[model samples]
Target: GSFVLKAAHDAYVPAGQALGIDRDVFSKILDEKIAGHPNIEIVAEEVVSLDQVPRPTIVATGPLTSEPLAKSMAEHFGGDFLYFFDAIAPVIDADSIDMEKVWRADRWGKGTSDYINCPMEKELYYKFIDEVNGARKVEPKDFEKDTPFFEGCMPIEEIVRRGPETARFGCMSPKGLPYPETDKWPYAVVQLRQDNKAGTAYNIVGFQTKMAYGEQTRVFKMIPGLENAEFLKLGSIHRNLYINSPQKLRRDLSSRADEWLFFAGQITGVEGYFESTCTGLMVSMFLDAKLSGDEKPEFARETAFGSLLYAITEEEKENFQPTNINFGLFPPLTTDLDGKPFKGRDKKLKKQLICLRARLRARKVASYQN
Candidate 1:
């Protein structure tokens, strides 16, 4: 997946013919290409019932998919899909914002001033902080257990519950920027940023919340500029579904029963940002070969994609949870260089070398493709 085609071509082939690929942008382009094809009809509305969908389908409804569809998918696949919950941030209509009261600035003006700062007076910030602390939360369904959200991505309400200064240290840390009006840094700032290319909507950065929809709108509006803000969507916490990939999905990403259907991304238990994208690439490669009547290429266990796929699909199933790419997942070094297992000045250098090896292996695999 780190096959920087341009870098590869530049390193090995002639100049000007090199074409580098940003895997993230490449994946989105693939999605758009698949959506735009004449033979494909991507539906905007959710398929409420299986009766409405066509046969021989791939149900990639993702984590936020509905219960009925999820159940149907599970039933058809001949087993239950493992589930978990994820909290989502709320979206606000940009047009509804009173931008006159907000200023555009990045903290300390270090980064791009992409963020719209909604500054708060010391008194107002404290009051809002207190309200979040006192807000009520709804419990999850019986099958779902309430989990502490990830430390880096905790909901705003959760942060407030920790203490009065929690939000300041986390989301509202006014370390760098100063307010012109007061000539003093704000006590806290609720930053909003453009969510889409059109700039018609913005997201409440670090404002993920478990508060009831009704309560969310009421309390959020207490912010000065958001007094009449229109919420496009409220924040929600939900369980995410994941199968034990080592036990369920094969190395080819297909289940034992139906080879035609493939699992990719988080549903297959490939965790983290790049893991999901790598899974998608593997699925595409597997399917492309099968569709074209060619033998699928086997990836080396030492390769990045290969190591990750093997880790997810070949690891001990019972002990399995989501995993990010790490040295432990890769085939270990055999030599004891410099009185250690491997030779490197530090862990960072070791990882860089491992990444380099993986990319070379990926290029070799790609060369085998038609």
Candidate 2:
């Protein structure tokens, strides 16, 4: 295909705006964006050793980092874990959900009715569990067999292996949410959170799996509301390598051992296209400031940029894992704009408040260089 410019939007994207770029199109646009820029060269070569890379450099080699470079990084940083297998959850067409079989509500009566609940009776939930346990899983690659799965992205089937009731206590728990159209809680439930601003798609929260795609399509459709569900993206598993940024990188995402060295993208342990791009953009800004002798500005924690940076740079050092930019990363709100304490029900206003605060702060994260 010839070079084409196209725009797309995704819920996972901060601010819900993105450009859908394929490889050829990406090359064309990158050339255009950096046209006539000084002191930049696009070198097409195999980066076998980090030692050979120039100073003031960034390593944004992404998930499928080359073996040699990964080796160099491990040896240089004295850190382990060349890789881990991660599973992604499926995204469903929101319109396909049988609204009659599912009801919208916030679990535990917290926040707005931000999740679509698929209620299942005891018989159905048990049957679904049996099917899930019996479904054919994707066989691991030779390299993936020894690699551990990230705890945060643990596949649902793997959880089931611990016990049939494990899921009942985990993601499929119905402890707080009552059954659809009734006060009595269902035996188990499936929750779908809005995955896009348009509400066109819903992600099956915490449903990452290693089930074969065909088995996934057949088994997942057994849930009450998703009988005719259209999967926008099917769950998948892959090997990924990311650094422990909180312990390894600095506030500006530069190396602690080498001020001139920087890291970005998935290598920094962020798990989305938007997060990776933000890491690169932010790193460039910080690197430019350091090299040019200007103070680097920081994003407010209220903003997605800051929240993501906070995740990679300042999150709990123990049991670190990659994650998409999410509202969970945002700081909790305690009061309304009037500075009064919020009522119990006002917790529903929390997301809107966070967005409002982020928008206000994002205006001041300037990018233009002197």
Candidate 3:
């Protein structure tokens, strides 16, 4: 008989929403949900190694994975197991963005006018930098203090601490992006990228930080277009460890060295709460199908879930990195069913069509499975 084992404190709450809910309330809800399932066994102990467990185990420890298990996994994988201090940027409610102050345009008019750019005057930019530099930051735990942060994903405060000119030169640069009406560039620009399919949320591009939740809300609102911004999720930083999944795991997310072992969630290089949850679901489906001697079901490639799985399992091996669900991971739909070219059409309309097609295909797959 198979059983589920999880550490008592090993909950699946996202770091971005950690400060939003009371810990006791969150834990109680989680415990209640898990208790409804008969197979789950919450072990009030640590999982130090895979060797102590039975075969056919699935590891989904997420970004803040335990040190002992992480060490054991690294030894099992053998290649350069990557570690990075991941900083999550704050997500804002789309309705709260002040459209009058900001304009939508892609840099250099290269792609669709998708990004919301908030221009800042020279004085305002300087003031913003000063505030960010002085904001209270979350202190790392003792174990995480020594781990180095990846340069590409450094916290906003850490970037500001580098130099006053760093932000303007890097993420906040005004070059190649002129205001739509004025046709002039401001001293600095803060860009927000669409975060969901419905355009209900946007994330501050390159503004990932370790700032205290209150401080993040306060300082970010100082930006021109976000004076009354409503935060959907706040910025956070955590020590993330993941295997090179493309090189280490099979397409089914099973270990190449041992078919009995499986990997999922952040440990297998998929990021975000939604993506991790999808992986867990997919792995379960695969395992169930395999044990029952049935053919593995395939997810539609056009769907977000399938695209994320493809990126982690089938992307190039040399520079394998953890990825969140995004349109870039999805396959491009260049033509319609009638073989009509989709080029030179309105980008928003094209995206809508793509999403519609994906949804329809996914429904067909689901119906077939039923």
List candidate 3 segments past 4 Å from native: 1-27, 88-121, 130-154, 157-207, 210-236
Q: Give Cα distance to truth, residue 44, candidate 2, Å.
A: 2.7
lDDT of each: 0.71, 0.80, 0.80
- What are the per-residue Cα lDDT tens digits for candidate 1 across 46-69? 686545665333445555568787
Q: What lDDT is reached at residue 256 by model 3? A: 85
RMSD of 1: 7.8
The count of backbone overlaps in candidate 3 is 0
Q: What's the TM-score of each model vs. the native?
A: 0.66, 0.67, 0.66
Which candidate ranks first by TM-score, i.e. highest?
Answer: 2
After the best TM-score superposition of candidate 1, give how far the Cα of residue 222 lies from its true spot, in angstroms: 3.9
Model 3 C-alpha lDDT per residue in residues 1-370, reported as the tens digit of each score: 1112132123322213121222344456567768877988877778888787788788877777787887887777775567768898999999999999998877777666778899999999999999999999999888678666766678899898999989999899998789777789899999888765456778898999999999999999999989999999998987788888888888789888878788888888887655776888789888888889898878878887788888998888665667777667878878875679877568787777778878988888889778
lDDT of 2 by residue, 172-238 (tens): 8988799655688888888887765566777798899899999999999998899999999899998
Candidate structures ordered by lDDT, highest first: 2, 3, 1
Residue 178 CA error for candidate 2 (Å)? 14
Residue pairs of candidate 1 with colliding backbone atoms = 6-19, 6-20, 84-239, 84-240, 85-238, 85-239, 85-240, 86-238
